[model samples]
Target chain A: MRLSKLIAFAAALLLWSGAARAQQVSVIKFPELQKRLSRQNDTTYVVNFWATWCAPCVKELPAFDQLSTTYAGKKVKVLLVSMDYASQLDKKVKPFVLRRELKSEVVLLNETDPNTYLEKVDPKWSGALPFTMIWNGKKSKRATFEREFTPAELTAEIKKFLL
Target chain B: MKKLLSFFPALLALVLLSNFVDGPAGYQVGDKVTDFKLKNVDGKTVSLADNKAAKGYIVVFTCNTCPYAKAYESRIIELHQKYAPQGYPVVAINPNDPAVAPGDSFADMKARAASKKYPFPYLQDETQQVARTYGATRTPHLYVVTRRGSDFVVSYIGAIDDNSEDAKQVKTRYVEQAMTDILAGKPAATSSTKAIGCTIKWKKA
Candidate 1:
């Protein structure tokens, strides 16, 4: 039992050291997000809608995390917007971020009515989790995907918007 | 030519229609839906045709595993109890592929239905054909359809209420409102709504 305890302690230490700065999650409303999306800028924003409990959404985070590093210096910004209830921000969203050691900007969508936001954001979206939107506010050029992304697929999208 | 100019309106309509064609092409409001047979948790095949007396159906695509579905489970039961007697029955369908989401398997569905003593039919879309035809994208998605001759016309497609997380805090009951409108021999004032939910687990190719 003592040996197992020591190993567990070491494992916890390793996991703790692996995590970078804890992500500061900003809970924002749909109007605020719309304001951000409608900005006039050259920076390409890769925003992903995901939740803590969604299995496929969790599976695709590594891809988004990889892009955060691969384009760390560029004008590209990867934002992970948690579709998990805003009430779960401190309990689920923040802990999941720290545990996964996410290196991208994370935010919680603080809205109760999805009907108001879903259509405003993208008419094509069926309010499915793991939705992604790659856009540049400068040209009003945007591409929305309502599906999970593999690392390779994510990179290809990045090529279209970033490269 | 003047003939080409005359066809401009027709051509423009096609162009506008194509622009609105997004990924999923499911039933739209007022679209006639064919009856479908699916296996219920009671080891019986159930279909819309079975419920001849029902004026409308609140077809819900939900799963046992989804937290969103679980959150609204009790409210779903209440909906059936309230509206079923009013000739609108809740027909819950589990659309998640069992292989992808094990908790949504047939056995688990049966267990859940039995435990809850659901007052409605909890059917399984094992082939997922019905779900694909109806364009169900996520768990706890709803469609309220009213009988029109031999077919059912979609009256509403979307969320059950304004609040998904808290049933008590719900302000607008979309499905109930649709049922009320249909019963009143009028079209639903709020035809469609949307809510964030777990994506249906489709079988991988």
Candidate 2:
């Protein structure tokens, strides 16, 4: 009886963890992202745009994860905004995030038209993956990088805004 | 000291002027594109001028590695088959640097072309000069160039279709629409768009 009870507990634990993992991804519009950015008080947001298909983007994800963990206690928030197709949310994006056990907050940018939304994200973006934008709420200062970042580079960039 | 001060302003003006002369890099709609001699997969040199029968060129910057490129591969083949006889032949150029992206190397391109049985020429931009000139930022980037008198002018620039993931769900055929407009002697309604695909892998500086 005790063994059966323990087995049920283990199954429940597995199911609960699975639910938590699935809840990690949030489908966000550009406006919601803007609002979240504006609401931050003294936090420096390191928002990275990436996709599973983009080789460089995938290669550089570990750096973002390292930054998130290293600066957990700090005012820096690393939000990984996925640019994968909406149709790939379940089939690709979610599975990738869960498999990698990515610690950073992952969200899918749920916009259809890249033409209008690309400009809204950043006029200079040119619709490239692994794009990062660092902004400090207090200073109202922001910087954008269009290329992949190494862990040291990511940390240094975040430090600039934090300092 | 006076001469030096005056020289600084002239130097600054020259610097600004030089940057201006460089002039918003990349081809825009209506800009004339120079013919380039690039090596094709079939081990022969090909150029825009080589296709004398073509009225326009469907110049596409695509690589072997990109998932977006892979998804659009069959559609790209279909586009070539459908349009090649009608004047606009597809000229696919692998723009990614082989060193940076080994999967986009000449051998890989050749193998991919052979396996897919591409009817059109799949060329390699070894220096990526052609892609730089065209300002192709992503894989599967499309540019429709129409012959204008003695020059080839850019008529449309963007994606093949609205949906990159699934072909059946594609609502707007951007490339097809552009070609139709150009063939009918009308201006393309959507001349330029944000190209959504894998960023072209450039060699590290």
* Local error of candidate 2 at residue B135 (angstroms): 1.1
- Compared with the true structure, all predictions reach lDDT values of 0.87, 0.84
Worst 10-residue lDDT window for candidate 2 chain A reads: A33-42
On residues A43-110, what C-alpha lDDT tens digit does candidate 1 reach at each position? Answer: 88888999999999999998987786798777788778888888888899998998998888787888
Error of 1 at B107 (Å): 0.7
Per-candidate clash tally = 0, 0
Using lDDT as the measure, the top candidate is 1
Error of 1 at B57 (Å): 0.8
Encode model 1's per-residue lDDT on B90-174: one tens digit a residue: 9999998999999999999999999999989999999999998898899889998898877798999998888988877888888
Candidate 1 ranges with C-alpha deviation above 4 Å: A1-22, B1-21
Clashing residue pairs, candidate 1?
A: none
TM-score of model 1 relative to the true fold? 0.88
Q: Write the per-residue lDDT of candidate 2 for residues A64-116, one digit (tens) a residue.
A: 87775687778778888899887889999998998998877889988765765
